[model samples]
Target: MDYQVNYINPEIKLSNYTGKLFKTEAAFTDHLLVWLISGETKIIQADESFVFGPGSTFLIPRNQLATIINIPKDGLPHKAVAMHLSAERLRAFYNQESIKQKNTVSKIFSFHKHPLLESCLASLIPYFEMQENFPENIASLKITEAITILSAIDKDIGSILANFDEPYKIDLISFMEKNFMFNMSLEKFGYLTGRSLTTFKRDFHKAFSITPQRWLTKKRLELAYYQLTEKNKKPVEVYYETGFENLSHFSFAFKKQFGFSPTTLQKIKTNS
Candidate 1:
């Protein structure tokens, strides 16, 4: 896949992709507002998966791990406008407005074809080509406008936008078991679990009685084996989803752990 990004500013961008499906694992520091203009996108979180098509608008809160797949639809390229609502910007807006905080445990919020939001995001497309001349003040206003629209739509949005709290130390074992499918660095995993790198390693060892890397690899391979054998999934389909970066590495690790390649397991299952 050929991917391109046109920046309206540091925080706002137009993303375009032409070709086959592209997948990426990401954990954003700021909330993301995406307005899909064409094609389709699937976002997989630890607990759930969401799919969005053209004219879909969705919000991904900060400090979350997700695997995103972008696919071109029909003959057109996958295209979307994305805006980042930075904590700095949110602080200013919330402080000025004194928005009341509401507690929420929601993961992702989706709005389909909302006229006001669609218009707000659509108005920014022209600015992508004139990024050099785009005024910072206008960009700020656009962000503020988006936040206002979101607040109007969902009164409790302050729980996500107005409040900015770093991840607090949580149950490492439970977090790891639920989220190990994502391909993120150990440091990132530590941060999300509210630990420093050293603390993460120490706590992980205490909990699992094994190093984090070894534990993660073993768990991912085990899941891959089950998917290949019981789910009848192909190696190519299983590798990325099971947290390996590539098929070669997944095959090598699977063989090392199970004494057979993933494809070999599939062949055996098929022959039986």
Candidate 2:
């Protein structure tokens, strides 16, 4: 079944985009659900690889690095719609008393072709295609509807989202690799990695010869450079996506390391 997404209406929370046949490295700040309208996607999550085609739907856990390569089928552009669930929004629906928390790591989940979920997504086409700024109230309901349907399929889905347990010590390496894009403090990183500040520093030094701060800067800049020159992404978009707080700071560091600012690099790429 080929679903053609000729219409795209992007709102604050809901996004529709066309994919290119290039591998992209990104981490989701919020839990994300993606529905492929057509074409194929080969995504690497953690150490796992999953392929999806038309009518395929999947959930991507927040703070996980996803390396996605769009595999267009029959010369068709890879189209996808993604819904993001923010921490605040998910917490509003969470109930620790009723939903049992599980101590586990977050990973991607694949879903079979679900008629109800498909229909729900189909019904949203009009809201975006017909008008601009699709009603936030309705958008909120759509997300809620998605959660309900997912809960019916797997009760653990809800629990996995609601529980906020720090990552276990063993899982720290994987968590940091996926989540370094986020502009979180060292203490926060330690907490999420289930380590105290002292322990985190010790473990981090053992894992990488350099300090965490230095490593993070290098990693972010490395990702940003690719996004700008290779992906042709704007400086502002690259900065935000790679976790830089201010453009000035990002630009300063970028110039120092790369010998040119992002804006200059973007222009060079565009002209060439």
List TM-score per model, in order: 0.95, 0.61
After superposing candidate 2 on the true structure, give the runs of residues whose Cα lies further than 4 Å from its correct spot.
1-20, 95-97, 165-203, 210-272
Candidate 2 lDDT for residue 234: 88
Residues 1-272 of candidate 2 have per-residue lDDT tens digits of 22233333232222333443444565556787778877787775546678998989888887566666665677676766677777776777664337866765677888868887777776765565555555668777887788778778876787667755445666767777877777777886786676899999989989888899999999989989998878888886677667677689899999999999999988888788
* lDDT string, candidate 1, 35-68, tens digits: 9999999998878889999999999998888988
Off by over 4 Å in 1: none
Let me know the TM-score candidate 1 reaches against the reference structure. Answer: 0.95
